[model samples]
Target: MNSSLQLAVPATRNRAPVGPPFRRQARSRLLRADLLTVIAWASVSFAVALWLADGGAAGFSTPAGSFTALGIVAGLIGMDLVLLMLLLVARTPLIDGAVGHDRALEFHRKLGKPSLYLLLAHGALVAIGYGIAEGLDPVGELVALWLLVPDMWLAIVSIGLFIAVVVTSVVTVRRRLPYEFWYVVHLLTYAAVLTAIPHQFSVGGLFAEGTWQRWYWLAICIATGAALAHYRVLEPLVATARHQLRVSRVVPEAPGVVSIELTGRHLDELAGSGGRFFIWRFLAPGMWWHPHPFSLSTEPVLFDSSGRGRLRITVRNLGHGSAQLTRLKPGTSVAIEGPYGLFSTAARSRDRVVMIGAGIGITPIRALLEGTPFEPGNATVLLRGHSEAELYLGDEVLELCRRRGATLFHLTGPRSAGEHSWLPEPAVHSGHRLASYAPDIADADVYICGPDAWARSVISAARAAGAREEQLHYERFDW
Candidate 1:
């Protein structure tokens, strides 16, 4: 096995900026992450406080009043949690910068079942409380609510919608459903929230005419809507206009792999390191609506202070949208959202670095090789593929590693079905592990990009090799 490629080849020139790449503070990110946690919990606490401020304590003394008061608090907390979920996924810069877009999305998903449960509890408690007050059964009171109360029917429908959303979001169910179908179902959350809001103001005793609770709820809903519109809608439009990215050329890298080069104005102002990502929407027939999230294969190269430069993304025809991308023509306009993810040096916590990439996943590692700073022997690169051609831009990577003084290893062979190691068949037989290439991997920040299962294998090996959680970084790009 030719695993050890020549280290010191003829130095090839690169387009990276002269000097160290941009630096990010791990401390700042941790502090901001902490702040977000405090705020999320504090919002729930504030909801309870709002209830306490308005005779909530005295109402709980009587059994019927107690059920009514608890119902009100449950509704408030459920509403708060729902709103927080929306804000988490609004693609807000604050959340993305603090916890990264993926982590924010993870938090968003975790709240689904809890928020649904709270809403269900709110409805049941309110029905029982009202039934006791009116000397009717809970079912009779619920029937009266649906028939007589304004917007109560809509609230009932909202509960059904919330149940549908949560059921589809469960891991097993989500796995069986197509993503588009899941997305459409999840969008019903807004409809559910809107339908439920009317009863909060119209029927709830706490939010009676011109009460502080009414305005507070109104403000939060408005703010959440505004944030969603700005970040997810307006910001993409503004960026499309400001940068004006257009396809310059499309170059085929290997079978099923192509690189799309895009040129735009002020590309240097793009606020991300080489390994970060952007969600791209190419404006063309049948393709303009589909968004593709891809990391830069090459960082932007600005020629002058005018910020006129080019950016490139290497794509493999993994799906329908990417297959369409491989056929893109020159001069096609593009709209974008982000430069998000923690796959860059912004995630670095140590001086040394180890980068691992398998198959087409090596593209982002190539960009990182060009832009990240490291001393001659402080960085290591491992490329895993079934063959050399599967390396997809292996030559360029080798050049970059040589120019940047980083070690490079090529593990190319068939898979080993026995042990399921991330290394190739030959390497697995030889007992090579993640630490074999980069012995200091435990002290280095390890960046991995690849298929989900393969990346998970790499992660497991890295962990077994003593790599800390914070020291290992990877991005899961799901649009």
Candidate 2:
């Protein structure tokens, strides 16, 4: 194995199962859409089958005829179930910001909805079909359906639990609840999914009717089980195994702005780019419970030029953890884990790049364009700030652009009187002028980092200008 491929920690606490490469398209956003289509088609097919069988068709009487329809229904429902499981596992890691996690979870919930619908239909079809043949009551019908295989009640409960999970996962309810609480509740999905074992073993006669079925279940269980263990258990163990860093300097850029720097051995070993960040400095060492995330505003370089990289974190006081960080001083030991996320420019496929930086979110974009082998001639930097005073590193940015032969477009709010030198062209919201200011809009890969709202705007404009989804990248950082 490659040395770099070595696992940093002994294990992960909770990791989702890996999905197929195709599922990575838009990170599984299409799963829900595709599942819905399958459900719709399957429902129509089942309806037609029921109508034909009720029309006194002799085909319904044959074991082969009934088995074929059941097989079709089971196959459609099973495909959806498999996709949902894949989606739940391969999502991006959650760092300081919740956007990535939220998006993935939303997609996961959507994909499961259609599966739940199919499962309901699966039960109803079985009960109704068997009931009609036997002339049984509703209670007896249900019992008879399970009578085919008594242990299938586990499947019934699994379906019920799946419904419950989907209900709670909805945005309306999920938002009103605490994230950690919701997270724990979400983790229970494994138990609900695992409980389907007995039913699938007994009644999923298509796959589990023979010895091969047992192996199939075993394989699925082991894969999903490993994912759960990695994310929930192994990741935490790995983080805990690492040593912490001591906070060396907290330089105040302004009252609300600050740059916190830290020093530690092996800090240089942390792989990151401009758009990524690490969960940082929580309560104490070994308490890998809740570490905050921050972007590196400057280039990733050896902090002191001695090979041990120093981390320079630029932070804008936003919430509880951020506000408290201002009080921390030199010598305060901190723990940071995760150089996770693929939001950087490196994640893209194109060479021509367009970047928009709002507030301190400029850190990662700046780091990438400056530290990496990126040339300015192929990129455009659109820096937005509240005012000239709020804008940091204007001179440094200009120098970097000059070195790379890149164009720098500075957009700032209106001033009271005199003209400003930093405001290169008059700030205009007009679409034409905005496009003209950044000529790279036509073909360059667009990267937006900073406030979510601003990033959203840049993405809208980029997409509107015909930029492909593959060329769009965003790093959401709190100001």
TM per prediction = 0.92, 0.68
lDDT of each structure? 0.85, 0.58
Candidate 1, residue 194: CA error in Å? 2.0
Taking all chains together, the TM-score of candidate 1 against the true structure is 0.92
Candidate no. 2 TM-score: 0.68
- Cα lDDT over the full model 2: 0.58
Alpha carbon deviation, residue 262, candidate 1 (Å): 1.7
Candidate 2 residue spans exceeding 4 A from truth: 1-88, 91-109, 130-157, 202-210, 243-258, 279-288, 291-294, 299-307, 321-337, 389-405, 414-426, 429-432, 476-479
In candidate 1, stretches whose alpha carbon ends up further than 4 angstroms from where it belongs are 6-24, 209-212, 417-420
Model 1 poorest ten-residue lDDT run? 14-23
Error of 1 at 308 (Å): 2.3
Per-residue CA lDDT of model 1 for 39-128, tens digit only, reads 999989987887787767887887888887788788889989999999998988888887888888899999988899999999999898
Model 2 agreement with the true structure over 314-389: per-residue lDDT tens digits: 7778765577787776877666555555556435445566777767776666766664344335667777776655
Candidate that would win on TM-score: 1
